[model samples]
Target: MAGEVPAAAAAASATLLALELAWSPSTLTDADIEVLVVQGLLLEKAISGWRSYFGEASPSEDWTATVVFRSFYEKGFGLPSGAFFWGLLHYYGLEATHLKPNSITQIATFIHLCKGFLGIAPHFNLWRALYHLRAYPSKGTPDVVGGAAFSLHRGGKYPEAIFKDSNKRWAEEWFVVANPTPGLLPRTGLPPVVNARWEEKPTEEEMVEVQVLLAELQKHKAEKLTGATVALSFAKWLTQPI
Candidate 1:
């Protein structure tokens, strides 16, 4: 009888601790959010330990803590990080099977982050990050969410068709479709018909659109790009003569 009472008291203590640790996004401080992430990791580790220590329980699917932490991270931070979601998936013991909704969301957020919120162009680093998210997926990769990883990453809200569009691939397809040779300069001395686009300038609306895009990207998705890539790709092209 005494032992039963002690067990009940332990249960009560656990309940109280859980309630205390519970998170409400509105009340979360940076420090508290950090704590929540750590605690979520600890729970994941606990499940791992149980599997290793006793082999008495199946792999843990106790994603309660992970789910809670993700809710906080997504709401408080407003931008999703692949690493963060991967941590949550680990906590849930779900190996990110298939083109899971979260996987699509993370990759889309990744591209959107790189585009300064324009949501175009596939940056290698962004692709690398997505690769990392899917790296050790539990059940191997199920079919991609949509045809492209990024669109599906955003809960199918985005359509990735543009990425593969022949027109959008103009920069590359230009060489194949419309090769601009020196136009056979000959004794006839006709000027070469260089089909280059020469634009005048922009208006206030264009300027505002650009500025707003930049600001929105920074606010919702962290932009971590610079011109270094352009120079690097250019340098490589120069060396390779491509």
Candidate 2:
């Protein structure tokens, strides 16, 4: 009977932890939100252009572009830095995969961040931190969520289980999107687009819409993005070098 009681206690503890992850509000700061919005906008532009240029061809054929885009997504959002979402997860001592409902919601949050800028649907800021942690390359660090494993180490969302089992080669779809171009010019002057965006400021009616969205996101649970769109945006963002 005593053993049974201990087992029950352990089960209860596990359940409680799960509940905490599910119910906890992300500890995001104003700065973090600003960065996410900026990163999302940039990615939207990059990915859109990549898709348009590449057409139906696979992105694996253009590796330099892929790495550059990943760098923009990870580094641009301060994913590897101490002040971003990873810091929040560090505060809680949880890994990206261990997030509330798992990694899907985290992935959804990245998508939403971009869409949110447009004031579109599913603007929930769910998994704001976890998404960054999962997407950023860990550089073989054991303390960080990703280590030496290719699936976990590379920038961008960790490979989905379906991706692994589909026999379509997730690695090719993800890591080796295309051949690397040594002569390609790096995209550094991106219009300071995010700063210019903030300068516009929100309207009074827009503020009310934002408030309503926030209220909904507070209670919302977590929530792909197509390859054509991603490739087009990325290609255009890099090739034009503007």
Candidate achieving the largest lDDT: 2
Q: What tens-digit string does per-residue lDDT give for candidate 1 at 1-242? A: 87999999999898655533321222323343345336442223233221121211111223221122222222121212244444433332232222233343344344444443445553432232123322222223222111112222232222222222222211111000011122111111111111111111234555554454445444433344322332233234322111
lDDT of 2 by residue, 1-242 (tens): 87999999999898655533322222323343345336553333333233222122222234244211222233222122122334333433433323222232233333433343334633223222112332223322222112112122223232222212222121111111121222222222111111122113345665565555544433332223332233344344432111
What is the C-alpha local distance difference test score of candidate 2?
A: 0.31
For each candidate in the order shown, give its overall lDDT on alpha carbons.
0.29, 0.31
Q: Residue 3 error for model 2, in Å?
A: 62
Residue runs of model 2 more than 4 Å from their true location after superposition: 1-64, 67-109, 113-169, 172-214, 219-242
Candidate 2 weakest lDDT stretch, 10 residues:
189-198
- Candidate 1 lDDT at 32 equals 39
Model 1 score (lDDT): 0.29
